[model samples]
Target: MVITVPATVPIESFQRLRIETYTDVAAAALLVYDYLLTFNVEKSLIWPSRWNIMKVLFLLTRYLPFVDVTLVLFYQLKTNISVETCRATYFPAGWFIVLGIMVAEIILTIRTWAIWGRSKRIGIILGVSALVAIIPTLYIEKVFLDSLVFSPYPSPATPGCLLTAGNPIIAASFVIVILFETLVLTLTLIKGVQHYRIASGRGFVSVLYRDGVVFYIYLFGISVVNLIVIVAAPRDLANLLAIFQRVMHSLLSARVLMNLREANQREYALAGMQSSPLQHLSFSQSRSSEEDRLSFRRNLDGTVIDIS
Candidate 1:
């Protein structure tokens, strides 16, 4: 059975869909702007560190959704576009979204790695798993792009690029993404619990538990809504929901990066301050009682014993 959207939808319904799409895109853009301006200081993020580099990369991902929306709006306004041209224009939008999601997922994986004591094995395993998960999304994207279909809107006034009559397999792509996101979030929570147990709720460890859980829940919630909209919502509203999802991905990914960095900094700063007063307590050890040498060592947790 070949499912097809009607070439001529009711005029009012189409207009409503258009309005909803506009509103959703506008809201997403505003959110990205708000997060960037509120939390990210340009000078602060310019530092040369692994976290800062990743923060810069993550910040760059925020524009993908906006750029995709701009292309969509441009195509909508054009009067002389062929079906092939329109299809070509919309093709990159899917890949752009996939790229944005992939970048965000990478940041999540990095956070998980950090929470796992930056173990090479754990990072490698998570990285490989994430890469494996991406294969299906890419495959589905190819299928969707190959089987792409387009039909004109109901109104003559808004005649340009045709609206997409979405494919079933295309919707299934989001399921793969959501599954991978769940996997990452689960690993994060597990690592967080283990760390809390081992460290006895040490300084700034709560950042992982609190921010990690909250951010994952929020992103997962958005992913669930995105999948639901793709699978069950009316076709007109599906794309709008997707737009919202990408925007939130960009916003929250950046916020997570910022939060984790701040948490790590605060932890180190506090540890340094606490250890400052003990720095002068140098102990001397003599091998044969003729000469003494001073040894300097610092332990911030106050658990180490000085046998000398």
Candidate 2:
């Protein structure tokens, strides 16, 4: 039974789709460029570090996009892809994006958790708020994906899938993202104010605060644009910024980890150089004791700086 549906997508939608393909490629290119630029820092600073939860998160946020964007580009650019194949790809691709965003948020949440002196109460609050935001957003995405109606390609030469229409309810997901980011930014600002009131000058804590605020703002702005497009633009333009948002989340979160690690290493090196000769001699004589001492100090500093 051949079920034929009329072509409903306009020429303008195809033009927008072409632009979207370019955007995805650009996002992927940026990911590769960033990786090359930071490869040395990652090797020197991250590789030697012991295996930990944060290391796992950093690697996921860093490398998962390679696989994601590859799949996305293939789905978008592959010629003669069947409608069924295109439909099948939507669920995994959408979930992959949601997964990336969630992991990045976890990194931010942990950072927020640390800045509050690792208070269990604060941790619980953040954890619960994340869940509240995430649950509804996921539900909305699932509903939107399930409701999507794909139009058949006008010709066999068509390179990608086309959407007949988009559900405006998808905008809800970005609204939730903006709200959650607002909560995270508010928490960071409150903590920053408290930290600066006591501390006279900038230090590692300042770095965490600065990055948190800046990244949150960036993510917030992107989410706003995404929401506006989904609500105000044509159905074809609804997802124009989705790939960019995911890439930014991965890029910025990876930077947060790398910058924190590098700063910690520099602080440790400076502290070591300033030690007295007698102290150095003592440390040299008891290498094992020094290792333990340094390890404890690293953990303490990591906690203060929200490395986890």
Candidate 3:
């Protein structure tokens, strides 16, 4: 069955679907991150000290949920809701929703880095950058909108609705942000690798650090590496708009699952030690030492009798 959006949508059309959906995703990401922090996922992999990193991610992503949701609402309003942009005939135009998804992707990427690499400093930096960058985007987008003649959704395709500067300044700002993110991701990879080497040095100590870093490095190698290409991503290149968010969602979920499994495995190991091997060792050593004491006591008694 084919779905179709209406040709004439109310002003709040963008706010309805895109913003609401993006909010759902971003809010969920923030919630999962909080749950992980509350559960001490970082402490499981690194130390309790690392919980601060996850805490920062949770807070920052919580802020970003609004960014995505607001933009999604903006897009639905801006969108014609015609067959051109909305994926279906009567529903949302996916192409134009790229703007909202891009915001979402960047936010999600921040959480992903914090989770995998234990990155607090980077999260703080990115959060600040995003705040500053939004000022310019808002000013630029608004001024550009003012010069337009027709209200959006005046007709099918909405192609002639208005003329807006696909502002290069706004585009350049995102590129700079992406470049900053790339740098942060690179630093995380280096740290994770260093931690991995340290963990390997500990003789029989199970994969506390080694596995943590391995997962981080794997995420970087697989997803972060691809993101480097997007640092120079073009403004009108609408196709790449959704690329970052969709990719981060997949990678973030994967790492979270792996970290959860490792934590459970560690708990099982600790539990097994408490129940079996540790108990046996304590019992055997106690029995052996008691027997030796009894023998020595008998020997002392014999010596005293001989002296008598």
Candidate 4:
């Protein structure tokens, strides 16, 4: 009896797979490091805080990536994985990435809505826009996953799954993401400018705006790069940035929530130190209507603050 062994993958293909594996490993490692760095903040500011919708969303955005990243690392690092196993694992991994991004976007949407005084009109608009962007993007993602062409492992020793072709239509999902982010950023900037003009100090509102803008910039750049890689790169090299972008969505969105909570804690502490009724009166009088609407007030436990 004669047996055949598959030929080794070409050097170029092996190199690309190596690079992709490195990216997956980097993303997983970064998430762990970030979790450690922020664990103290989470304990102090988040764990003790009253549970609200924002808190729930923050927790979801903060920790859900562990599951997604684990799946990704498995898919990328498991040697001798079958093509059937790859097909079964890959879509779930993709869905996890999408779910992570969607949850983070929800957190940002709520933040934007809060900065805008939680106006019902603005909330309605954001909600509608999110639905519009999300539903189609999800459908496109399903189509993209369905269109993937996975090849047999180039060699028995080849690490991880191999994709020989993919639908560039996946690029459309990133385009939608970029467009939605633009809208969110525009709203944030307009409110930020208003806050800058009226607010006298770097208060909670300032922290919210600053973080929102910075987060937008980083996520926007990543989304663009992901789109470009999908559209222009070879199928083997496509999706190189997908996991990184999802990790950023989780990491940055978590930061935005934590920073806002921390700023609220500081302002609450500072306000408590002031004893003069006259000073309070003067400060209240000086605030514009918009500033008043954006004011932060702490809960009885002093662990949570909300823009009222």
Which model scores highest in TM-score? 4
* Superposition error at 97 for model 1 (Å): 0.7
Which residue runs does candidate 4 get wrong by more than 4 Å? 1-9, 276-286, 289-308
| Candidate number that wins on lDDT, 1 or 3 | 1
Candidate 2 residue-wise lDDT, 111-157, digit = tens: 87776766788888898899999899888888878777776686758
Candidate 1 ranges beyond 4 A from true positions: 12-16, 39-42, 47-56, 76-85, 198-203, 268-308
Q: What is the C-alpha RMSD of each candidate to the true structure, in Å?
A: 8.8, 6.0, 17.0, 5.2
Question: Which stretches of candidate 2 lie above 4 Å from their native place?
Answer: 1-8, 276-308
Better of 2 and 3 by TM-score: 2
Give the candidate number with the greatest lDDT: 4
Give per-residue lDDT, candidate 1, residue 101: 77
Model 2 lDDT vs. the true structure?
Answer: 0.77
CA error at residue 167 for candidate 4, angstroms:
1.8
Return the clash pairs for model 1, or none. none
Please say which candidate is ahead in lDDT: 1 or 2.
2
Prediction 3 global C-alpha lDDT:
0.39
Lowest summed lDDT window (length 10), candidate 4 = 298-307
> Which lDDT value does model 2 have at 235?
62
- Comparing 2 with 4 on TM-score, the higher-scoring candidate is 4
Tens digit of lDDT per residue, candidate 1, span 179-254?
Answer: 8778878888886666555443433445545666787788789878878876777666666566667777777776
Q: How close is candidate 2 to the true structure, as a TM-score?
A: 0.87
Error of 3 at 19 (Å): 18
**Global Cα lDDT for candidate 4:** 0.79
Give model 2 RMSD, 1 decimal.
6.0
